[model samples]
Target: MVADVNVFVGQQRFLRLIDEETWATVPAVDPVWVDVPVTDYTVRNRPKRRNGQARTGSYQRRYGANPSGHPSGNLVTPLYGFVNEDLEISLAQLMMEWGFADHEVKFPRSKTAEWQYVGHDNDQRHLGLRVNTATLAGSEAGIVLTLELIGQSSVSFTGAASPPADRNKLVEFLFEDSTFTLGGTPLRVSQFQWSVQRNLDVIYHNSHNPISMPKTQFSETFSITPMKSNKTYDDLRDAFGMPELAGQLVLKGLHNGTGDTGNFTVLTIDFDRLSLIDSDESGGTGAIMNPLTFDVLKPDTADNGSAMTWTEAA
Candidate 1:
């Protein structure tokens, strides 16, 4: 199943925070592009068929076609595809440069408390999350960000058994049942909702001259959603190539809000205020670090396994 993952950002926030005139002149930040391969399989059963027949005789006669066995089982497979094209920023740089305190920033782990199922008929499933600095460390500079799949827990199906009939209900259940833990604490699933109307604001002012004629501020809100699969903690850890989950947030914008921008700007926005609203009530402080530095500790080249698949068995 494909996981419905959604990401959202405030566009005006960046524009309000940066110099309006210089906004266009800012160097473009290159996005980290990666292709994820998805696969799916299905099973179906066919009932036996009978033929018509008739017979007659002096006394009595009757004839009927023999029933055939069930048709041969078949497997339907497809290569599901997705692209991770989101502009990420560095949390640390944003805090220091933007003059905003850590308490003013909020990041989302998942879009909705509901999990998203992906596939031809909603049978396939996927999951995603917005990992920031807070997920990495309690209080320290050097640390790694990792996602762990504690284990498979029992999940209940309360929605309709047929497809398209219970789509909304299925979506709701998808997010409600899925849970995660950070630093040994189980965070509730309700903490993933975010405002879709918000944007990134950047305020640029002269440090020395307070009352200057040339005052500029830029604001722009960016939206980030799970494009394909809602990755688990293990999936994320594997993607970043870290032994443990502990890293900062990476903003993938630098080209004037256009993902097409061939350039990229990296900023680190620190997480000052954090709380656990999920099953694992775990919270802590986190900061943004250079991607190069983060990668040095954990290389980007890692194995991303096939997307998880599911099917109904007879």
Candidate 2:
């Protein structure tokens, strides 16, 4: 007999962020943000194997027979997209899982204050995630997350369960319209790429499963057309040797504004300690462009708090 197979599309997928306040509990809040650029979501649980040696000195490996080991699991998802005002808010929540603090501050003259996201130590903060696809047949299918650190076992798994009502909730940010700033100058961006990573240190115990701690870092690279009299190139050259002379990149989004009293979404990234990791100033037949890369550094402190900021529009 033949079987029917179904395939999934890239764009029809959505990622919802849930703040699981505690371990193994269902989240209660509505998804922080839906329809994030989640390229792939994977769950893996692989355990080490052991072989048995008999009296005859012959080795035999039996599958699931010896059961003499602990296992570890991992859930991995890669997200990518164009940077904008609204998306920055969701991105901030995602970064928080990798260990960042969400700081809310109210502007003196405004009703709503801007938000500040700072890098945080890799504490034992557990989070929840949901990945689903809107199918062509108008149905939804995906995995629900409920995971806890396996005691003495370094395993991770997405527990199959409905999210609860008391889950930690992140603020909602929507996309309306946005503007971009490169090197403090206003321009529409053509390319933007950024990534966040956690460096995990595994700790092993004498008679228990190993545990892992994480340290997080991020990097970004982008390309843009050269503007007439643009000093970005020269500025980058000057900053190349002097790390303190790094620049800034800002993005702002506006909503429901007739004059100025509408809502605003803002993001600011400082490159003060960033190194010019890569650069390309092509002299080809096309419009001259500059593509640059930076190694993100913590500015002026061990916490590296000056890397980025997410400010809510007043």
The candidate that achieves the highest TM-score relative to the unseen native structure: 2
RMSD of each: 26.4, 12.2
Off by over 4 Å in 1: 1-110, 120-133, 137-262, 269-314
lDDT for each of the candidates? Answer: 0.22, 0.34
Error of model 1, residue 39, in angstroms: 15
Question: How well does candidate 1 score on lDDT at residue 123?
Answer: 24
lDDT of 1 by residue, 206-303 (tens): 32111111112211111111212233542444454333322222222222232223333332322111221111112234321111111112123341
Instruction: Please give the RMSD of candidate 1 to the true structure.
Output: 26.4
Please, what are the lDDT tens digits per residue for candidate 2 over residues 197-281?
Answer: 3322334554333333222223223223333346555576666564323555554434323113435445565555555565556
Worst 10 residues of 1 by lDDT: 11-20
